[model samples]
Target: MPSRADPLWRHRPPALLWGLAALAVAVLLALNLGALGAVYRRAGPAAAVFGPADWAALRFTLLQATLSALISVALAIPVARALARRRFAGRRALVVLTGAPFILPTLVAVSGLLAVFGRGGLANQALGWAGLPTVSIYGLQGVLLAHVFFNLPLATRLILQGWSRVPAEHLRLAASLGFGRRAMWRHIEGPMLTRVVPGALAVVFLICLTSFAVALTLGGGPRATTLELAIYQAFLFDFDLGRAALLALVQAGLGIAALLALAGFTLPGMAMTGLDRDAPAAPGGMARLLDGIAIALVAAFLLLPLAMIVLRGAPHLAGLPASVWMATLQSLKVAALSVVLLAVFTAALALAAVWSRRAAPLLEGVGMSALVASPMVIGTGLFIMAFPFIAPARLALPVTALVNAAMALPFALRAVLPALHRAEADYARLSASLGLGVGAHLRLVLWPRLRRPAGFALGLGAALSMGDLGVIVLFAQTGGETLPMQLQRLMGAYRTQDAAGAALLLLVLSLAAFTLLERLIGGKEPRHAGT
Candidate 1:
């Protein structure tokens, strides 16, 4: 047993390690705020204020995000209910597949979207065959479509988790009462949606509000511009740091406001249980036909673009340029470093929050701030900070990795904190009663219990890092390209086949990294004493 004053105090609960972790987070925040402040001081108050153009961008951002949120949630309800009530072949696999888009790189998803929805793409071709007017996917409609594409599955998964929470006894009682679908929904599912939908809507809206690459690629014109895209244009294209800083401030304000608006609708924990248990199946009839159609349509909608990417890119895989390969290596390195950083940051903060009940919310709040702190905003601030001190372009890889870690921190924290809390609640007393030291308890108890969620967080962080394009765009120079940036260059140069191949490669890599990390870390379940 170690004394309170032991040299291993650093490993104990309520240790200074948590403080150090908090300090590191503070420094990261400070550097960005400091840069923003410096820009404000230099630019003056007038430069930071919004103009008519800026207001237009703000309006577009809100409108698209709002529409996207509503449509995603609306479409998700049937799909989620279908998934919840019906356990068919590959249903579990489909549930897992739903998570793929959330981690799929923005640019990669955009490429796939364009292949399916762009002018002269499959949808238009089909419409032409039908003698129907063609639709375009290069404006506000396109932006909203892409947002729904990415977020619909996420909304489904979240709502499906809520469905899983409907108490089995309550459901059984409904069945005993001869309740039909309408009654079940009225008494059981409707209330669950009331609890789940607002938070889901708010989350999806905030994510879309920070849209950058999707808008950049498909925005098509000024009318489609988002605040994030404006920030990128202000800094990269116009070299106007002051305007970029101002826009970043405005973006932050909107994000904070949106968060405050949604703050009352608490997000359900990501940790899921009892999924293996079967619920009372909804009676088969027209309901089954509707559910089947809903499931089929969603599967097609979610999977067709991916199929197109694969079909188109398969022929071009061998022709990928050396530059693309090099960029892939660079991306892997960045993602690896990002996973390490994110793991340390998330674990420390989560543990610290669990240890200090009074400061838990504040500590967790700091972690969640990454959600609203747009990557481009952070990158712009860091670029401004690094400009005078070093060649900002030279530090692109490291800065990108750091910003990627920061960007993924919020999700990682969400995945981890709940699991940590549950593990602590379940095992804390048992370990303490056994006189296990902090280090021993963590290694023997907490680590085993936490492996699943930790792996999930790490996988998500790695995938997001690998796919990130925001900060890298601000700092990348010759020879410093990431895979996403490299793919963008390929597309710019009319290397369509090559870009498609690279998109396929990136998609495969991102999914593989996420799958491998999650499985490898989340290994086989542990056996308990009796079992």
Candidate 2:
């Protein structure tokens, strides 16, 4: 407190970081708001709030999202409970695998779903052999199925994290009291579920609401279109800029309303604290039987599609088209660029949030905006703003990378902020007393402490960028296709084998990138100054 000789900003550089972060967010918002302004200005009295088609799309979007959220949460309960209490041979492996779907490319997942549920797919083949009618997975049913496939594992993991928070002493006390399965669930699991389930449901619902790739591929026709898909159709197909802008605004409004309504029910923090330890509980025959069944069913549901993709795609790998390879290279470039952008933005924002008292809340809010801002809205908004000067098609890759980085910033921040905060808390005074300047402090103190989480965040960004198809759709034309876009094209051309092969390649690349970054940079253990 008495050190007048200290550099003014040596303790923290919040202003600089805040300016950088705020500028990025402002650009995104300006693009969206600018598009809305252009639409209203150009359309004059012709602008609308909703057309009949829009109403239909809204209804379908809400219906599918609600169903997907409910089903994912309800089904996750039993599976999460089983995972919480049981120690099995592959328990850790199962938990790790649960995170796969979250990073898995959407088109790859859609292809896998199609392989297991389409007309000539395994399920339909089995039904035909049994002289039963085959079910169609081409409408709302297909969309729900795909959403559940993507979200169930996520729900289970989130709820499992909730379970992990239960104090070990309480479990020991329950075991000492000879609490049966019913009593255990009544007092323990039920309370945890009450606290976690609503937030889980809300998050899943919001995710499904903005779903584009699933609806685009499996949503049969106009009947199953979501609001995001509707915006795409309006702009790309009908060339209706006014309608697209109105839909983007509507989608944004819906997302904002949902965010406000669910703001109180904050999702459980996803940070891995390395605090989980086995809790004592009485094992019973019935409990074990039920847990086994729950685990088996969930495993089958999650794994079968991936298995089908591997089996079906293997034979076609050698015959993959040259376009697929080109798209793969393009996808890698986009993902690498996105990771770099995301890392810079997230690091700056995280530092600001930790160091600035007044700006923390505002910076955090901007980061969280990525969660509610539909990719379509941002893509359409930017498209409108760019259309006046340069062709949007030429800027497709860069724009896609930028938007992907923005979309991924929230997750990256989640990974980095906690570690950064810890590092600052532990070493801020030490560095200040040592007269370490900002750059030296960051390089000597923060970098080592932040490496693990930074790597994890970067890995997440890369995987997500690799899989993203939403913005690319609005921008990219024939020669500029990403891997996801290429997969969609193969599917459109009825080249199922090639599409499956491409899907497999995309999946492998995304996962491998994630794994390599997490392993190589982060290592296996959490490193701290004292430790």
- Clashes (backbone N, CA, C under 3 Å), per candidate, total 0, 0
Give lDDT tens digits, candidate 1, residues 326-416: 9999999999999988888887888888876777878887887776776776777777778888999888888888878877888888788
Range of the 10 consecutive residues with the lowest summed lDDT in candidate 2 = 269-278
Each prediction's whole-model lDDT (CA): 0.83, 0.83
Q: How many backbone clashes does candidate 1 have?
A: 0
TM-score of each: 0.93, 0.91
- The TM-score of predicted model 2 comes to 0.91
Which model scores highest in TM-score? Answer: 1
